[model samples]
Target: MNSRKKMRGGPKKFKKLELYSRISFLYLNKAFKNPLILKVAERKHKLVFKFLEKEQADVIAKYKNLKEKKHDEVGVRYIWTLWWQGEDLAPEVVKLCLNQLKENSNGAKVVLITKDNYKDYIELPPYILEKREKGYITFQQLSDIIRFTLLEKYGGLWLDSTIYTSKPIPKEYFDYPFFSQHTKWADTCFVQHNLWHGFCIGSKKGGKLVSFAKEMFFDYWENHDVIVDYLMIDYILMIAYNHFNDIKEEIDSLPYSSERLYELVTILNNEYDEKYFNSLMEECIFSKLDWHKEYKLSIKGKETYYSHIVNLQ
Candidate 1:
């Protein structure tokens, strides 16, 4: 009987391996510039959308007549970031970014949300807490929930801990009721378009878009235990944009922003050039960087961009 069970699992394991190999190949080759990969990705994206269409319909029906509550005018006066274990346990890169955020906050209260104190800011439903306890919701996904809930309840800019700020967050970010880093469709991967960088979002208190997004997230978790897509936040945003005219208008009105959010990371290993670095900083206030990747502080006796950023006061 044991031998039979092992035999039954062999093909399933092999199939998973085959799928992972294909994914790795496509990632390494930038989708391999392959027509077949593009077609397959397009088809998959459509299917995912189709699967969620009913949920979109339900959300629209539920919120179609919704009226926002009146709140005192409070612009984005808080900057939020999360490090689940706490900042003292954060990676070196995250600490550097946190310092930069404080240095350039321009009076915005920089709040560091940690596992010990996250509940002080937002109260999530019990079901969501149960799911988290059961390991259904990850720390990263919890951060997503925290961001929307905080934005919905109180106006602020939610910055992913990985974001590096070079200057005071511009006043333009606070001008909108809802704001995100907008980019052209051509700038995205084939699987995604109509995406606003979820890593950085600026919003006003009681904004409709964020309030709806929080509802959508709650609805999703109430009915489903497993996440359907890795980029579920982006997918939720896309669904909102497609199904609601008001949400669409709000997103469409946001100016193109942070077009080069990843440019600094690309040159992190290259020899540092102060002129080029200053120009890049002048162009964009924030750059999204990854803490998971290993970067050299100095390469072969030459200082790299990563080194320069780390050394910046």
Candidate 2:
């Protein structure tokens, strides 16, 4: 039998076509450039509206804006990640992020990944603008730029448009685990802790971890995986941790649940037996660590330098 026929034998040929069709529809509407295609594309673009309304409402209601400023003097970096439909949220996201950044006394930058008319659709603060031109770049490509810019220029915190910080994430938060010369591993290691703490999406770190994420854009050529762009930096953090044990110590020193778990597991595995480790792993699965709530509470109500600034008129 032919290769195509053999592949189709296990799963009916039409099933593959149906899957392809659904994916294509999502892409055409959500990611593609042809305005004509969006006119004929599926209803998933509605999801973008829902995401925008919910995230925007939450940000506006909770955070107050300070004076319109050209830059932050204290130099805390806030990077915003955007993919295709995410562009729809760009203006609002920038406003909200700047509000939070100003509230925290920090600088902000936006990284948009698409070949769309985001330039026309969104207006941004002077401090915030697109980092790269829209081109034939993949999710990984965009993520690399974010990491490089953060590490080299902005100091490693790419805030998503949907993510609104009520408080500041201090440098002390990253003090644990010794800093590493290896940028890739250091970033990934940090991400693993952040995700475990609920700051990111996936469980892996670095490029390898990101590689595991299923491509959402394969279905729609234009609708590349924006979600992956948000998670890519964290994914790099995981990669850094896995390859470099020294950096793990930096993450280990953090006062988060995942850090505690790491310490406990280290003791249990080292002092006890393999059986104990297995039992603990099972327990971990049943009662997964919630990093988001923990991080929120850690910085909760803490009077940041930007607190007074956020209220500025």
Candidate 3:
């Protein structure tokens, strides 16, 4: 039950209104901070305005051309997200997000993973998809499989559809072995793989981390205790990615066993400033470089190259 309690919190599917309102607010706020500013912005905000406009168009183009957007593109510039329910349940806001990711990709391929066609795009054991179709696995589980396949086979970015980007991921980052962060709550080791969450993970396809991650994820899914907590996924990642002889003791020492998550959900729901969202998006655990030496999670220098609107409900 404690394990269940710890695994209770994760980001939810995005809402269309949330994306519409936030991007709108960002542009409107910039364009009209004051009447004089508005006058200045009329001409000055041209670049930013055009960028936003093109972002929307690209998103639409990607959707219309999803069949043509090859996921085989080389390098870390590719972007992938999952929408298990397919386009029918995907909202317009989510479509806009696909564009936002495309915008951030700087011409790299952007692919949205959905249950209907994930097999066509990602390589995995046929049984995994069979399990998904049998209702024996959750979409989250399916997503884990998809991300691992993507990074292992073709290194790139895997971001949850909920994230909205402000800039392209730095090219230098792709040169790294991989990129991931220890979740803020991971200081205590509460949630699971402190290194990788669903937010945004990057790697050079076929890197050691991605390869190990692929096998570790499958190991847990194929032969684990019947307890159905998603935390086990991270737990598997941590163990697989590292060599902790006393892994049990190490995991037990992590501080994730608290009610802080409940408070976070409350704060996100109440519009208590974007700190919550940014923190969730960021590598809050202290580290000088993108990779944390002790926890072994990759940390981005800038906390946010993107934004998330948590209270869209």
Candidate 4:
């Protein structure tokens, strides 16, 4: 098996997509260039709609002029992809998850929220744009804010577009009232550590934990000067862990390549237990494409920040 995430298209050609200065010329979803790893794995579901489609750079470009949408019912089993600023959805990846959902007893719903549709879901203050422009909240920070808001408003799994789902995830993820990967706590000696990861988070709609998260996130957004995106998420989770008697974060279900996992684990201290860590190992099955394994990713155009992710549409 190839250890590296296989891809075609050299970096120079990848930069061509950004040459278009017009908004209409901006590479749309399926129409855009790929990421550092251009090829998506072959497995995919059949149905493709606006929520998940190619040829829709329009979906990502209208970042400032986003509209709002009506809220869905609570407990809807959906996977959200916030492809703001031309982040890679890699059409095949979207298909893989959708197809796998069909394989299940009951398939899940797919939701792709771009900058245009963001305001509809999240009623954030107008100043968020100012924060974005002032550089206080980067697109990354904005993503963190939106993830929490979406998870709170509509219950489901929120996967960073960078994350690719391999097989069907376990039922406990959707069933649990709340769960997220704790990047800070997983390896550290602090068994009592309360760090909570934001990359992959799942929760019940309007759930107390998520509501608390919404509050905590906005509180930090309103007051903080630094870009401690996960810090706000982590800090509030610790507070929630204490306040909510029923909510405790579960193990990370996002998989990683064993080689990469091993490399990461080698540096950690011994306080992590063998059995506990093994449980997490079961779901850590993805091969994370190191963004700069070869040449560094390039950036161009004012339309978005993530022009480097190669596309396969």
What are the TM-scores, per candidate, against the unseen true structure?
0.86, 0.32, 0.52, 0.51
Q: What lDDT, from 0 to 1, does candidate 4 have?
A: 0.46
**Model 4 lDDT tens row, 186-289:** 32212123244455677777666666667655654454444322234554455445434445423333222233322312322223344554444455632232
TM-score of 1: 0.86
lDDT of 2 by residue, 1-313 (tens): 2121112122342343344335534553245544444443223333332333332333222222211122233243333344454544445334444455445533344344343643452332221222123333444454444333333333334334334343444443222212221212111112232333322221111212222121211111122212322333334344434444433554454333322233331231122334554455443311222112211211244532223222332
Error of 3 at 112 (Å): 1.0
Model 1: per-residue lDDT, tens digit, 1-313?
2121212223443344345334534663366446566555555556557656664567767766665445566654888899988999999989999999999998889999998998898899998898889887776677888899999888889999989999988765776778888776652333435347888887888877788778878877776666555566777777777776777777887787657888887899899999999999998788988898888989889999999988886
| Between candidates 3 and 4, the lDDT winner | 3
Which candidate, 2 or 4, has the higher TM-score? Answer: 4
Per-residue lDDT of model 3, residues 1-313, tens digit only? 2221111222121133233333433454235344443443333223333422342333323233222122333543667777778656866445545555676676667788886777787677665655667666677777777787888777887777655454565565455455653334322213232434446566676755556557655543443222133433454444433343333332343333222222322232132346554554353221111111122112243222112231221
Stronger candidate by TM-score (1 vs 4): 1
Top lDDT model: 1
User: Any runs in candidate 2 off by more than 4 Å, and if so which?
Assistant: 1-94, 106-136, 139-141, 154-156, 168-171, 174-236, 257-313
RMSD after CA superposition, every candidate: 6.0, 19.2, 20.6, 19.4
- Which segments of model 3 are wrong by more than 4 Å? 1-76, 182-186, 192-196, 223-228, 241-313
| Angstrom error at residue 81, model 2 | 6.3
Worst 10 residues of 1 by lDDT: 1-10
Candidate 1 lDDT score at position 105: 91
Evaluated against the true structure, the overall lDDT of model 1 is: 0.76
Instruction: Give the whole-model CA lDDT for all candidates, comma-separated.
Output: 0.76, 0.33, 0.47, 0.46
